[model samples]
Target: MVKKTIHEINARIRDGSVNVVTAEEMVNIVGELGPEGASREVDVVTTGTFGAMCSSGVWFNFGHSEPPIKMQKVWMNDVEAYTGVAAVDAYMGATQLSESQGMDYGGAHVIEDLLRGKSVDVHAISHGTDCYPRKVLDTSLSLDDMNQAIMINPRNAYQKYNAATNSSKQTIHTYMGSLLPRLGNVTYSGAGVLSPLSNDPEYLTIGTGTRIFLGGAQGYIVGQGTQHASAGMFGTLMVQGDLKKMSPDYIRAANFTGYGTSLYVGMGIPIPVLDERIAQATAVRDADITTSILDYSVPSRDRPVLRKVTYEELRSGHVELEGREVATSSLSSFKRARAIASELRDWISRGDFFVSMPVERLPGNTSSHAMKETEGVSFVSDIMSVSVVTIEKDASVYKAAKIIMETAFNHLPVVSKDNVLVGIVTAWDISKAVSQNKFDLVEDIMTRKVITARGDEQVAVVARRLDQHGVSALPVVNGGNHVVGIITSDDISKLFARRH
Candidate 1:
């Protein structure tokens, strides 16, 4: 378990508390609690319109690794997080996910770092979930032509958009996971509109309790045709000049690629939190492995849910809130991204485009909870150790190193015959033990008050503390202080860097 400060926080700070911050007592902390640098959830993707195309069927061709793309999750000035395409083709067609399988960057945006520009997020996307791996950086060429070239490709990007397509309330309820009585601010938007084509009452709008913040603004009621499964069906999202300039491939991809699977577009208003409002969604998710695995696991076997958010409250992050500046930029940004996509697709004809991103080390398995795949992985059960070390209090340095070299472990637990963990003997501790030379027992050189991880706690929280403490390994212990397993920095490094 991560031990709290033994001294007061102020005292710890005075004695070099690394990056600890004073507790917040200001106005309510806005935004969800994201990791240090990854708190900022607003991402504005402005696809430029480019007119270029390539012959069909050159699928899976990574044209180059140039102009790497990236997404930034801005949290605090110093404590923020980011991730980008470390290596092109490392995670084939599957969407690259960090330990956390939350959405940050999707398609072409994945290659942004190589093509870093003004509009690119000021920070990293927090997780290097590379999707459309672009070419590596080509300093010899300009990014303008390169980006345009990529957008012109007709390769269908894997999107999880689940927007409304039919006037059928069924589609709305399915995607929204709830019911909205009206569309937008208009009265009777969902169940009220009559479809001329179907000659039936169309729930063309969102049902109750389903509030999707797509445009930069919230509470928008999109027309039926706009939300169809077809690309550009949601109408053109306004964006920069370049994407609109490339039309054909953009449109073709949209026409072929299914509308994204998510309920809404705004980044800040993450859907998982809102989905909990559907009552027992979390519990239902937990009960089934498949349900737990799906980031957007829907069509659950539970009872129906309803959306109860108001335009004002959702936009402003308040309930029954009055006169607050609604942060609809998340929605607005999506609209712009969509518009740019449409225009870019309109500009290009059907062909393939090549975007490039750099090759960073693929993230290895790590103890950081953030690194755990949201669905498949959860709490780390036990870190596999090549060897373990158990030492007596009087074990000599030579004996310890000899033991270490034999077992392939750099650290050992020092215990008495009674098996009480009194201290730890480490490679670093051995260095000390040797210098002192007079030491006869492991305790002579060991560090006391051993740091550890609880078996039941999440990995990310424990891993962060291990990093903060500059410790190489932590003992996994039970409430009774019985050592069960050990986690080393090498384990984390191997997990994240994949260097093992």
Candidate 2:
């Protein structure tokens, strides 16, 4: 059989004869007609998502004033904008916090206010020059006064993202929204099948230069987005568009309490059913896209995974966790997602828009690495004090207390005559021993089941162990279980402080 071409599809679209379907409709059609038959009938599938994207920002060019000052610094409604471009150009990052209002209002709010046609205070400063002598200017400007306004975002529309739940006793304020303590609520962010990249799993058609529906306006993919995970699965794209064509309804400013500002961007993509494989890919459902529920309480690159769940289960309003059904809420608006899909479908059916071929395919094997500390890794032996103030197990408590006071050490490791670590004594132990008039022996008041660290253990690992065990110090021991050094919280701080 001859394969259908994009030109043929465009011809049908131009003649008002093309069959376009929303992502939801395409799923049912593929189920009924199968991939081959659906590929022959369906010309396009429209997908969409409306979710918080913090990497979004807008660039503006203010018209020159009477005394055209080369703007060295610029601020819109007290939120700073990047003035590195030229005299009149500035870029406002969505997450840039408001200097006066803090996280409550930010650059994202400025963008939203501009889209709302509201006036904003514009403040600029410059070093005086002969041609442009104005040192400072403060005035109000609206979007209508700007020469060019464009939204250029580095990362948006993740294909799949993990749901978040707090396992710790305290609530966490994160970009995922507020995570309630002890899994009080679960929050997920993507629009599942309706998400653009989720439908186009492989960047087969959606790639650099491909036109998209961005904030209800025409936009194009620029490049691979930041944190664009490995292919054959999660994918992301950097997108840009003219803000003039966008509406405030499709793009809103959001302040994630403790996390800062982000843009709630509504975007859509039209997938051309060029072949059966493409048709099959677009037929993915909520149940097919899988992601895990992660505990954000753990402060580590590798957080603990609670459970893996399909989007279908998440969309069902509740998911089982720890033998109980937990309510789930989505940060992305499904209603708006459906509306974007429907609108994009109408645009395609009316021949107002045509799908463009990608200029180049995105890399399929790229993965992000965890950011390591610039100071580099330090082991227990590197930070541990070799001249450890040791207390003999048979030593009197009075002697131990005197040594601790003189050295100002909070903890002392009690050892045998052979220097084998037998126990650990803290200042609190000496205090209690002295209070009760029982200062006979150090071993009587010392903790026998003492935790120790190996000389080669990573400092971070040992530090975490200390935190978990509620201990301020760990005796560094060699292979023969002999105390070689001592590591305390203070020593760890000093090590990090020196490196930093």
Candidate 3:
């Protein structure tokens, strides 16, 4: 058994004698030479992934202007940024929407624009202070003007992600892209065995302080990513890099039609083939990796898992689902992923880059649990009245008034013909209608912007909404915005009275 260390690999890299191969190439090399032989022949294996990571963002320190202001709220290119840290520092998340362009232009676009050497409009406002008295600052600058532009992403490079499919009748727009109705198609977003985490499934060489290729720039892994659990089939990495050194080709801005914006980051990790174990891991193929196909049509966090399918099946362009062949597609670019891995391999073979051992292995054999409410906690559905009285939008105001007179209820949910909640009509609106003698339609007198609650909402949140809106009642709706029940201030009072 030829046992080597990362130090040995670094020495080889420095002496221009290192032998490197990509994860895909390792599969073929292992097939020909076996694990032990491959480990002795190959010094390192490079892995890569190019996918939409919504958790990505950039932090900036704008050089202060004359009569500097303490920036409390900031916007770059009309997209809001968090300015809670310092007077001239702000962090803009990629998914944040633009005030003027909404989903069309967002923080991701601003980040890419800055990277592309374009000028960005910056506006900041602050409450006048004694030390920093200036209230507002508006200027245009490029990336070269910033003191620092660091990309500190909380989560990136998911080891494996569930494929998405919709079983509902209507198409749903999600981060997974538009899932066609009735599982018309499936969309996945991982690079299979070529992925960084997939090549180092045990977090052996890939950990905090691990040097990586990020957005065409040398970067480092900061720590374990959010929602990382070693016990599950999924894992993630938290990484950071200098945005100033990144390239537009490896880092791009993307906007899903209805899912706002996310950053497409190209990342690669070099794994030192220290022994047979490392070589065996790097030889993982698409057939060995498996993930579930989750129903994205379900609104809840615990979406229904349709079935387990291998990456090979997903890459084959279709998969069997409910006895039908569902077309499969990848949201992550395999072509870009292969290019990134090849780039990293070349960097290592040319002695320009070297792999490093992890400072400490990431947590392993740990399980994550779904959020569960404590005992005695109640949701709006627990106390809401199931027998809800609703009126159609096209109904007459006289009919609404008659319903209010006949029943003790003061509010009626105005719905469409398909029973979708559109508005709400209160007795006060009906009284105004009667006084004005304007009995045209229920929708004309109803409040179109109805304050509503979801069935899954906690009672405390619903109470706050009711108090904030100063509304006596709220129509409880489902995911489809169809009113299923009604919760009122009186009902909440009754629950507390009973508890007492």
Candidate 4:
């Protein structure tokens, strides 16, 4: 049960004696040899993910022109690049859509073309300076011609993500992919066992400054990503690498019809077999990770949760929802993920790649808050029906039954002579009164206990009271118990429907 140092593993890799395996393989190894024996035998466990990463881009230092012009604006292959840096530096974001081709092409395509050794048209305009007299420049540039080309992503490799489905009557076009209406299909976006953060679980050995294989090139974790929920059920990281060493096959441009453009990133991480804990972490399986199935049609931050499912069920290609089996599709490429893991393992075995300790640890207790609406909360007064039909306490049971049938309402507020809410009379009450031959006043048959809501109260609070009381509606009352309006389940549904 000896803990091996990273240096000793690197030495073994140099001598071609290191035992390297993919994260998927580590599961069986740990089960066969147990954590201690597996940790001693295994040098590194490689993990990978190949998915659409929109927060990806490459910054290039295109060498200064003969009559240098500070690039105030830039476009490569019709895709705009941010030229706000220096005179010759520019950043091309993956999701920046092509101006001419719309969603069909973008800056991600420019990166892929550049990596493929193909030239791209570069156009720039600048406010001419004394040292740089050129006002504009139109030219074609290749990767080899750039002074420096580096891929720096603010976010990539999400640890875990929910599978999405549409529970409503309309299809939903989202970043998760198209969710067919009424749970026609489910879409998930993770490599399960091959996902880097899934294998690492806790930040453990993988964190800021850790070396990794980024888009076919060696890279380092820069920091916590935009939504790096470490205390989250899943984990994530931001990464950077030299684009000069990457290949076109590992990085490609993607246009998702209505969803604009993004980069198909190929990434891999090597987990050092330092201890039994490390080995056990690397052996995490798809069945162990769970994610919720969200109804994307809700169109709110608090989207409805349909169900919770494991990655193993997600990978099975279908999941059951609403008593029907719905087909599932993956937004991530498992084949490419396996290939990247295998390639990373080869690099570590040949001493071409080495793991590094994190420069900084990710915060473990950070939590996310939902975005609040700018407008004030809606109250029951706004949505309640003002023209409420009521039955007087002195009204006959036959009269109350007639009013309920004509309005198609299940219940009616029973009011006193001065228009104050006395009780509630339902259609069932009148029917029971008639069956008992007690065709007297409505108050005699009505339920004396009435659930009432104040008009100034929040709609959510009123809705909760209706649910708690197991009632379909609540009589909205002003000061002194005067019935002003009526709030019903239908009203709440309509309110949320409009908001969504």
Candidate 5:
């Protein structure tokens, strides 16, 4: 049994005698010396993770002008910021897109530009008040010009995150990244063995007021993150740091093709080895941590878990799913993560940084639950028409056109011989086929990548699918992929009309 205290660790750090090592190095040290011996020798273990954190933002106060206007609307580098707090203070979220540049530029870019010493155009509009009468303001400002610039992230440093793969035939662009069709690729985030929360799974040394390395600058943990679920193994942290002191190398901007923009944050946490338990926790390996592989193709609040795999398998550049080998990739940079941990380790060894015990431990055994809607709410099965008109993929285009004209339905679901949904055909597709004089099989003119809904899904989820894909209808299917019914926009409109 070995025991120490934060006071002893601080004294050693101040005297430049603290023995600090990165989490990656601690693994080997523990294997050689055991947890008790390692606890006696290692004073602190440094951990790091670098990846896209969407719930991040910067809040700044633009010093009042001579004709100070109470900014009601604000834009930095053409991106909007929330200005409901004060006269000139505004908070810019990382995912907000630019009005003119769209996804090419965003709030994350503005924050990175400010860190790089670039001047951004600042424009604001305000109602003329008695004291502050200026109605408009247009100026150029730098990070130094702001009275205070602070990065307040709502959530960061996920303990362990699920891997994502798509089972649909069409590729999907999401915040998780672009998932290839049919589980062609698997993408996971987090620095497996070097993640901050992974080293302190129980939040023993990392909690409120815990000092941390945030974006190459010192930061503090504020409180529990928004969606902290310890029981689910998806814990998070809320942190704040000085934006002016951050380095561009540690704070960068990124865009996910169709998923707007986000900020790539470099963060590190140092855990004090107060006992053998703490040392053992810090020495966790990738193979010891496991996460579920979730199907991202499902458009709902709850997605099906494909399987559970350890980080070792996920980092090997491939994973086995249902006997199929799928290529793997990492959105988080492990190289930068190692660099961050090494930098923190050097800072502690040189007496430039000291570890502190948390004021209060974080909550444990908590779980996140899905939002509950009103009882007896409508589902796709409630609003869908049971008499679904379908056509075989091998049916003639003339036959599909005849069915469409007779039923007055614009869309027809194309199914396989086993009565499973395979594709869909529209009136326009049949018209084009007839005009082009290519009245071939329905499979030739049908859309292979069909968007579908499940009978058990909520109506609102199905409605979002219809709007997201710009389609007018969806075929509701069963667990076996059998088309049970069809839901259309008209059915939703009628439901809304009756409810109101």
Candidate 6:
């Protein structure tokens, strides 16, 4: 076994004097054990609260995705302990808000889209309810619904997300197969309305500890961006979250990083596949790290031993793992409605929140606002309108209504021959026009006093317009008052949310 105790390694970390080593060199160091004794040599790498500590004498000071410059030598024990504590901290400190309330879908599974970007987890059971082709379901879960929820139980880690396919299969196979026990009280199983994120290293670190690389300078999540990047030993592709971005090609080419080198990369096979290449370069065999758990299919990994769990081990079979205490003791369906309703009632009783998402970057070059303005040029003028669907002012409201039906836009500008903004039109307006259907002349029914802004206008003004009118969109007009582009409330809301 590695020499130092977790406490000793932790003390070194606390003192800012821990000796750190990377998987690159660690793998080399472990190679001495030969492929025969490899599994026994691999340390139980912990994260979140637990900091890094090697099974050997070396202090492995590290955590997942810490870039270089910020990364320094520390005992692996220290790093493991830190992560373990951090995870505990997150769980402990998370307020018993709506998320902590009651709702049990036996366990959860996270679905990720490795290429375009990460997709949010959708509960396995809820996935079906959400994508139900039957359409008999009354409602869909909102973000607030998800936010007020908690990760109440143990769950499976998933690979992909096909909303429709999963939805249908879940209802027919899993929910029906397993849920018959609950009887006819509108019961369903799998994951509930929300799919909580699975950050546990056991589920997330598919490439193993050394497989992930943290190149360049690593730092904290709140600030600090990743600097340089490359693949390393154990097929590791380093791209720390703190880094600005991770490059695929850089990871694709590199095999061996230096001893004790840090790596940060996206989480996926390319990472492990790369780590395998690096391991070959480093003369590290697969047995050097992989464990012979006998049956890799063993479930309920939080325990010390690996074994297949039977339903008989479960109390009530579908017991609400951890967060169930509150779900039963504290909340009733009436209580749930009241709790959320209380929020709405409080807002009603108190007042309203006038949130704004200006198109320009926040005051301090923050990425909060999706689109940023140049030094002088306005965001509106620079925006190139694409996939635009237009309708003439002379066209009947029915024609305008049809445009919105076939296309995605909810609003369009009423431009005259000179391309001047004669009036503003929207689906809501078209709906009103259709309802009224008073006249054939578009001008007679057109909204004459439209809320128009100059092309040079600030996105801040656009944000303000949305709030004042309680409207979903606005049109961008040129200096000659010609409609050049359009901005919608959705864009502003999404931009603002991303920036935050």
Candidate number with greatest lDDT: 5
Top candidate (TM-score):
5
- What is the model-wide C-alpha lDDT for candidate 5? 0.93
> Which pairs of residues collide in candidate 3?
none
lDDT of each structure?
A: 0.31, 0.90, 0.92, 0.88, 0.93, 0.30
Candidate order by lDDT, highest to lowest?
Answer: 5, 3, 2, 4, 1, 6
- Model 3 over residues 1-500: C-alpha lDDT tens digits? 87998889999999989999899999999999999999999999999999999999999999787787999999999999999898899999999999999999998999999999999999989897888899988999899999999999999998899999999766878999999998999999999979888888898898999999999999999988888877895778899999999999999999897788999999999999999998999999999999999998766678899999999999999999999899999999999999999999999988888788889788767666787757597889899999989999999999999999998789999999999999999999999999998989998889998888888877877886689679999999998999999999999999888888
Native-referenced Cα lDDT, model 1: 0.31
TM-score of model 6 relative to the true fold?
0.25
Candidate 1 at 387: error in angstroms?
Answer: 10
The RMSD (Cα, Å) of candidate 4 is 11.1
The true-versus-predicted C-alpha distance at residue 280 of model 2, in Å, is 0.7
lDDT of 4: 0.88
Whose TM-score is higher: candidate 1's or candidate 4's?
4
Summing lDDT over every window of 10 consecutive residues in candidate 2, give the lowest-scoring window. Answer: 228-237
| lDDT tens digits by residue: candidate 4, 81-112 | 99887899999999998899998898888999
Write the candidate numbers in order of decreasing TM-score: 5, 3, 2, 4, 1, 6
Of candidates 4 and 3, the better by lDDT: 3
Q: Residue by residue across 1-500, what tens digits does model 6's lDDT show?
A: 22333344334445544333222233454367542232233221111111011111111111222111222111110121111321111111111111321121101111001111333322111112222322111222222322221211111111111110111111212211211111211121111111101111122223212222111111111111111111111111111222223222211111111112111121211111112222222333213222111111111122122222221122122323223311111001222222222232222222221111112211122121234546443344444354455556787777777778988898777878777888877777777767776537566567766775555555665677578667776677766877777777667666566656
Q: Kindly list the per-residue Cα lDDT of model 2 for residues 262-307, writing each as its tens digit.
A: 8899999999988988899999999999999998876556778999
Model 1 / residue 338 / CA error / Å: 18
Deviation of model 2 at 432, angstroms: 20
